[model samples]
Target: MNMSVPFSLLFTLIILFLSVLISSTSAKKPGDASQDLVRSSCVHASYPNICLRSLSSYSGPANTPGEVAQAAVKVSLSRARKASNYLANLRSQSKREQGAFHDCVEQMGDSVDELSKTLSELKHLRSGSFRWQMSNAETWVSAALTNEDTCLDGFKEVTGKVRSDVKRKVTNLARVTSNALYLINRLDQSRQKTP
Candidate 1:
């Protein structure tokens, strides 16, 4: 009876151990794969937190490096468009900073155009033409980033609520653009590695 009890107890312990191990392993595999993908992609970003936050929401569909890059570009394009609209609204309300607001609006418009070009270039990114496409995208995105900086620079001479508001919008747009550029570079590197 003692021997049977000990065997039963050991059998139960073994089963429990196996169950725990299986559950732990299974639980980690899916989440780890997604997290690893996000971490690895974000590793190449200038703003990893922005990259992670922007891309993690689309982790399910953006499993590959290219997909992640595309998602980042889309996010960047959306941000730029929104910033452009906000700047336009602020430009209309500006009385003291009217000249500054006009210049900033023009810069924001240019930034939006550059971002659009980046998105268009990314769409043409294939393995065969990866270099050319990525180069175009990098150039356009860099220009967009520069334009955002220029917009902020224009605001340097102005003071008040309009300057602050436009600066905030442009800064956020610049961060998103920077994130997109990093992801694009990552995608290019990943493509180069493939056989």
Candidate 2:
């Protein structure tokens, strides 16, 4: 009789433990799961905080490394577009620094195009074509980042309100583009190490 009581108590405890475990695991929201993925993937990035900040705003959960890379590219595209528009507006307003503003506008336009190409390549990345697609995307994003730097370089001699304005926008875009590149490189490395 005593053994039967102990067995029943032990079974009850086991059942309780399993219930708690199941509830805890199931209680995690999709957002929480994706956030975990984001954090883990960002650990591989050069600028982890920027990567997380830029990608965490994506509406759906980025469940895979590819999804995270896609999100990063999208964020880069959006930032590049904004920078292009800002430079275009600055070019229109420029009276004294026409040459510098024009050059910056052209460089930013190129940067936007490169970023768009990166996004396009990333969008088409499939399991069978991961390496080649990632390589192309990386090249495009790197070129975009270079263009942003070149835009700032064009303003080295020009010191005025125009330089300051262009500098601010270009710097912001460059940082975001750099973050995207880091994430892409991370994704590539991670995939290579898998299987």
Candidate 3:
């Protein structure tokens, strides 16, 4: 007796098996509460798209507003650090716009420091001093946003590719920082509302 599966049946079985395997290995689940919470938190951000995009890779539990704020601050801090490094490297290689690059690098450095403080404050928030800690986080994040804007402003008098590149990078950093600040403010408000 010769038993052979039809080619179409074999192909269909293989496809089905692969699909099942892929679905089983997928990380995201339908109606995931953590993901829902993350989306809701991002809704309140000034740059909601930017907030969601930046925060998409955050692996922390999104069970609370404070956690979302912490994640946002972490994203902002990461971007700020990268921008600072980029500026430093550009400064070393550039001839023209050296003064502007120098100032931008210094401002970006301050921005990184402020974002670091904000992240630290968020991480150590105490129930007894919740309001105070949130206030500090807010202040630090806002300061970081300002610092990023100042860096971009330094390029106003400059022209050409360097200026445009600096503007693009710094502006994006400022946007993400602004979104982080918005999320932080929301967390503070949420705390205030809880009895």
* Tens-digit per-residue lDDT, 64-124, candidate 1: 7777777887888788888877777763445547777777778878888888888787767
For candidate 1, the clash count comes to 0
Per-residue alpha-carbon lDDT of model 3 for 46-160, expressed as tens digits?
Answer: 8888888877778766677778888888888888889988889874345547888888889989988988988889889899998888888888888888888888877888888
- In candidate 2, the residue pairs with backbone N, CA or C atoms under 3 Å apart (3 or more residues apart, or in different chains) clash, namely none
- Backbone clashes for every candidate come to 0, 0, 0
lDDT for model 1, please: 0.80
TM-score of each: 0.85, 0.79, 0.81
Across residues 131-152, which tens digit of lDDT does each residue of candidate 2 receive? 8888888898899888899889
How well does candidate 1 score on lDDT at residue 62?
70
Clash count, candidate 2: 0
Which has the better TM-score: candidate 1, or candidate 2? 1
Rate residue 195 of model 3 by lDDT.
Answer: 94
Model 3: what TM-score?
0.81
Q: In angstroms, give how far residue 21 of model 1 lies from its true place.
A: 2.6
- Order candidates by TM-score, high to low: 1, 3, 2
- 1 or 3: which has the higher lDDT? 3
lDDT of 3 at 40: 91
Those runs of model 1 whose alpha carbons end farther than 4 Å from true positions after fitting are: 1-4, 28-32, 91-96
Clash pairs, candidate 1, are: none
